[model samples]
Target: MPGFDSEFTPITRQRLFAGERLRAIRRRAGLGQAAMAARLGISVSYLSQIENDDRPLTSAVLAALARHHPFDLAAIEADQPTRRFAAARAALDDPVFAGSALAADALARIVEQQPAFADRFIALHAAYRRAEERLQMVDEGLESGGGRLPWEEVRDWFHEAGNYVDLLDRGAESLALRLGDGDGALRDALAERGIVVATNDDPATLRRLDRADGRLAISAALPPESRRFMLAHQLAAIAFAEPIAAIAESAALRSAEARRLLAVGLANYAAGALLMPYERFRAAARAFRHDIDRLRLHFSVSFEQACHRLSTLQRPGARGVPMFFCRVDMAGNITKRHSATRLQFARFGGACPLWAVHEAVAIPDRIMTQLVETPDGVRYVSMAKGLVKASGSFARAPRRYAVALGCEAAHARDFVYADAIDVDGSGAATPIGISCRLCPRADCDQRAFPPADRAIAVDPDIRRIVPYRL
Candidate 1:
């Protein structure tokens, strides 16, 4: 039988030792060192040397164990060294070590010589992350009255579900087909159900549902796309009421309000899916090379809608590029966020000011693109656009926000915004952070505060871009 030993080089053997694993296996098998050595036809001293990492276990011994004992050779040879090294690198990249120059070789050596210590450090780092999230919840008033915020709970539910709801999507798509396709097909379907679709001039009334009278009134002030979205949303709530209720019931939310809000969220998701079927939208996205404007026009959806729908293209085998989508208000408050990629937003504060999203807010109606590199060395091709929704009256303030969408650099070739950008070229990408409090970049001139986890050294006499040194 083919064995893993053939894939191992001498350097790999030195880097990865299975001593601890072998000892655990032997102990679990209820065999003493002498007995185990005798079964493997090796001297007791040789077995002791292998268990202590003084000698590498031979392939013959591994095969013997596999043949006669309940041993998992693949488990013993799982590339733990690489995983531990990556974990150590991630931990050391924290703000606590901002100015410390720890090389990759040093981190690898720590994993090799002090694996137990490395494991402890990694676990501690995970605890720190949880603590940070808790602090953020406190700051956001989520910990008030000893209950989690409804919106936050809904957000977490979506995140855990991979930001995709197959049942909702398919149901909505089937309804869309039954309703027929055209500019007035949705309205016709609603009218057939004795649901009067009317528009209101009152700027304050974005949407109102009158179940007693069987009417749905939407604000005439909204854009065409938003108007259609509102209609589709109401349609989903009425047509798929049973399915939505079943899903919400299964959630077991802590509060009735949470359940209600989740129902609304699910209905909205279904609306988006109804307007843009998964397969059609995904194929169009690829054909347009993921140009937001093109997708918006082709799908007859708003720019924000197109961006949000792109983040949900997480179908199992036929998946599109994984992307992160977010919307930030003029005050830098994150109103909506979801990521199918590894790019996670800050749970507490505003996004990094250096990011192009903020700049997009200043230049409304224009799309801004940037190549950004995070502290972990992963690069992304990000695009953002600012939008304003008119209130249709002088007394009411228009809603303003910027929506950002992006994917990892590895998928840049399929992204239109990345066509003229050199994502891999040196000095081509802007260095950005998750947030100031959690960012570990010591030289960032736009840092609003020193990292909360790191110590700050102040020098009144030698002030640079920032007042303190990390």
Candidate 2:
């Protein structure tokens, strides 16, 4: 009886890759061990040896040998590149460095150390490419898209995990450091660990550390807030890499490299949060009556940082104003958001044009307020404001945004930003949903992608304000 081989299996292919063919092919040829040994000019024991992978059929043996049976070398090599591609792909699967060359470089490095992780990356990439192709076809079938596009999977992974709060909490409790309001505390702590802190350059853009020079220059590009963030983040990474890596390694994550990177991100976020704990800042913020400008004075944190930290106060029963915070720039791009309350800032595409968050950038340094709601009747009082990162000296320095907060409409009276949004208006709250796929609103100009489930009707009789007829 002839034995049949499965289409694919890692071990089978790897064996053939390692040139283990003597056992099967010689047997199929009905050649006994001694005869096969004579034909290959090797000892009978040597023939047995190569078959068991105990000794290599070195290039010399392979060149002199010939298969006395039917087989297809081309068919066997067909899946070889796919195997290598899978490894290369696995090495590059990094969420932090997604959409950049960093992922590819990371993958190459992984190939040098752990090839299995790299192989998994390749398999995942192939699956992703196929899924995206199918999704595009689905979009084409819709003819046109309107409202928030259904990019739920991409959105949640990129936006939610990238938010840094969860990672911060995990890393902070593990470090067991005392967080206080003093600006010098972090620098002093790092110094105790032989880490010298200097205001040489912004930490993010500083490429490498010159061990010989004993100098740590910051990037002149960063704003004060970003400077503190990058510095604290790096310090945290140095302090907690081992423990964080341990957590990541044991996390049962899809990829091992992702676990390592998550450790870095988690460490950085923890460092920043440790420099500014929730309880202390929340208390100072209340004393100032949630006045962001004044809170920045008390704690050397930026408006956005102060505002963002405020939203994370999920302490039992002593909760603060349960606000939704957003940080945006002049172009209406929502750089980040931390929300405990329901404020629908588009997780994909552009935000609603009618919303004050988009308009706040235009009215620089002025607070823009609005009353918004989702279709299911969750109302919010949102405050949007622009933030200028660099002052007069640093003209080339980038601009940023600082939209302090929002909360349930019922709590609007306590916030100064909700002074005039008219939450009680009978008109529909401009239909907003999470991402385009989840949002069913038709013809919203803010939509970056069309809703996945929108039953868009086209009559051509009336022109919709949005570019798409959906």
lDDT of 1 by residue, 395-425 (tens): 9888899999999876665688887888779
**Tens digit of per-residue lDDT, candidate 2, span 119-232:** 676677657654644454455335435332323332233233324455555456444345444546656666666666555444345423445654445565566666666667
Query: What are the runs in model 1 whose C-alpha is more than 4 Å off?
Result: 1-148
Top lDDT model:
1
Q: Global lDDT for candidate 1?
A: 0.78
How many pairs collide in each candidate, listed in order? 0, 19
**Against the hidden reference, what TM-scores do the models get?**
0.71, 0.56
- When summed lDDT is taken over every stretch of 10 residues in candidate 2, the lowest stretch is 66-75
Error of 1 at 139 (Å): 9.9
**Shift in Å, residue 464, candidate 1:** 2.2
